[model samples]
Target: MSLLVLLFAVIPITEMLAVRLFSGIITDGPGQFAANPLRVVWQIVVFFLALAVTRSAHHLIKIVRVRVFRSGFQAAGSGVPPNKESWQWAVAFEMSNVSSAVVQIAMFAALFFAFDPITGIVGAVVAAASLAAISWLYQRQLRLQRDYLETRWTPEAVAIPDRVGTRIKHSEIGAFVGTAGLLVTLIVVFARVLGGQIVTSDAIVLFLGLRLMFGQFGTLSSGAMRFARAAVHL
Candidate 1:
C-alpha cells in the first residue's frame, strides 16, 4: 500500500516537472539555450527522465492494481463463479482514480501556491465549490435511483419517482452550464493575456495547470460517484 501511494504521488510531481520544462523551453526560446548550452542539455535530459519515470510509474501502478484485484478475488473464494466481476473491476478502477485525483490536486495546488498565492487560493475554492455542488446533487440522484431500482425489482413494481427524473434533468443542465463557464473563463484569460494584464508565458502555464487540475477534478467526481454506486451494490 505504501508503494502504491508513493507511485501515485510520484506521477503528478514528475508530470508537473515535465510540463514546466516543456513550457520553459517554449517560452524562453533558443536564445537562452544558446547562452547556456549545458543548462539546456540538462533541462532536456531532466524532461526525458521525468517522462520515463512517469511511464514506469504508470506501468507499475497497473501491475499493482492487478495484483491487488487478484489477491482480493482469491481471498473471496475465486472458484465461486466470480459473479461480480464487473463490479470488482469498477471498484478497483475507482479506487485508483480517487488516489490519482487526490495526488494530482495536491501537487497542482502546491505548484500554483508556490507561484502565486492568490491564484492558488482561487483555484482551490473553485475546485471545492464545484465538487461540493456536483457531489451533493449526484449523491441525491444516486439515492433516488437506487430506491427506484429496488422498487422496480419488487413483486409489485411502481413507476419511477418524479424526484429521480427531475434530478437527472437538473444534473444534465448543470453539466452544460459548467462547460459554458469553462469556455468563458478561457476566453477571459486569453483576453487578459492580450491586454497585457498577464504575461504570455504565465498565461500559458496557468492555462495548462488549470486544464490539468480541472481534469483531475472531473475524474475525482466521477470516481466518487461510481465508488458510491459500487458500495450500494456491495
Candidate 2:
C-alpha cells in the first residue's frame, strides 16, 4: 500500500515536472536551455530516474497483489469453488479498485492544497457532494445488478441491463464533465482575481495538475462502479 501511494504521488509530480520543463522551454526560448545545458540535462536525468522508480513500484505492487490473491484463494480451499471469473473480479476489487480510489482521493486533496486554502475547502465540499451523488446512483445500480445476476446467469450474456449500463456510462460522463467544468471555473476565477500576478508556468501547472487530479477522479468513479458489480458476486 505504501508503494502504491508512492507510485500514485510520483506519477503526477513527474508529469507536472515534464510539463513544466516543456513550458519553460517554450516561454523562455531555446536560448535558456543552451545557456544552462547542464541544468537541462540534470532535469532530463531526474525525469528518467523518477520514471524508473515508478515502473519498479508498479511491478512490485503487481507481484504483491498476485501473491496475496494466491494466498487468499489457497486459504479459502473448497469454499471458493474455483470460479475463475469470480476470483478475478474479487482480486480486482480488493487490490486494484480500492487502492486506486484511495490514492486518487489523496491526490485530489493534495492538488486542492496546491492552489489555496479556499480552493481546498471548496474542492472538499465538491468532492463530498459528487461522491455522495455517485454513491446514491451506484446503490440503485447495485440493486439492479443483483436482480440481473440472480436471473441471468449465462456464461456469455451481458452482465447488466441496458438501463443500468446506460446509467453507469452517464455517471462516468457526468464525472468528467463536472471535473472539467470545475477546473474551467477555477481558471476563470484565477485569471480575473489574480490578474497578472500568476505566471504562465503557474497557469500551465494548474491546468496539468487539475487534469491529473480529475483524471484520477474519473478512474476512481469507474472503479467504484466496477466494485458495485463485483460486490454482487462477493
Candidate 3:
C-alpha cells in the first residue's frame, strides 16, 4: 500500500511540481498557471493514473512468478500423476503469458486507430520487446524451478557441470553481455537524441525498451551448455 502511494501519489505530485517550477523559471509561471490551472491538474492526474496501472501490471506478474516457483518446488516425479497445484501452475503460467501478449496487441491496435498512429505503432514494437524480456526472465525462473524439482525427485536429472564452462561463471557472461548491450543502447539513443531524430517521451521509452530487450538476450547463455540443457529441461 505504501509503495502504491509512493508510485501513484507522491512521485506524480512531485514530478508535476518540479516540471512546473522548471517551466516557470524559463518562461511565464504565474501566467500559465493562472490561465489554465485545470490543464496542469489534468496532466498530474494522467501521470498518476498511468503509474498506478503499471504498478498493478507488475503485481500480477509477481503473483504468477511466485505460483510457478512454489509449485515447482513441491513437484515430485514418482511416476504418479501430477498434483493439481503443479498442473494449475504450469497452465496458468502459459495462459497468462499468452494473454499478456494478446492484450498488448489488442491495446496497440485499438490505440493506433483511435489516437496517434505513429506513436502507437512504435508502442506495439516496444510492447513486444518488453514481453520478450519478460519471457526471457521467465525462462530463467523456469529452469531454476525445474532443477529444484528434479534434484529432489530424480537425482539422475542433475548432471555434472562442465569443467570448461566452470572457469567463468554464468553471472560473468551475463554481466559482460549486458554491460556491452547497455553501452551500445545508450550510445545509439544518445546519438539519435543529439541528432534531433528522436523527440517525445515515447521515443525515449522505446529506445530504452530496446536496451532491456538486448540485455535480456544475455540469458541465452544459460541454455547453451549440454549439462545445462539436460538439467533444466530447456
Best by TM-score: 1
Report the C-alpha lDDT of model 3 over 1-234, residue by residue, as the tens digit: 223223323322333333333443334435656888776566556656655666565575656566555555557433424544455444545444344434433443343323334444544454455445544544564565466556745745544453334413543454355455455445645665677665544344434344433343343333332223333432
TM-score: the better of candidates 2 and 3: 2
Off by over 4 Å in 1: 72-81, 154-199
What is the C-alpha local distance difference test score of each model? Answer: 0.69, 0.62, 0.45
Q: Report the CA-based lDDT of candidate 3 relative to the real structure.
A: 0.45
Q: For residues 39-66, what per-residue lDDT tens digits would candidate 1 score against the true structure?
A: 8888889999998998999899988878
What's the residue-level lDDT of 234 in candidate 1? Answer: 50
Best by lDDT: 1
Better of 2 and 3 by lDDT: 2
TM-score per candidate, in order?
Answer: 0.75, 0.74, 0.41
Comparing 1 with 3 on TM-score, the higher-scoring candidate is: 1
Inter-residue clash pairs, candidate 3? none
lDDT-based ranking: 1, 2, 3
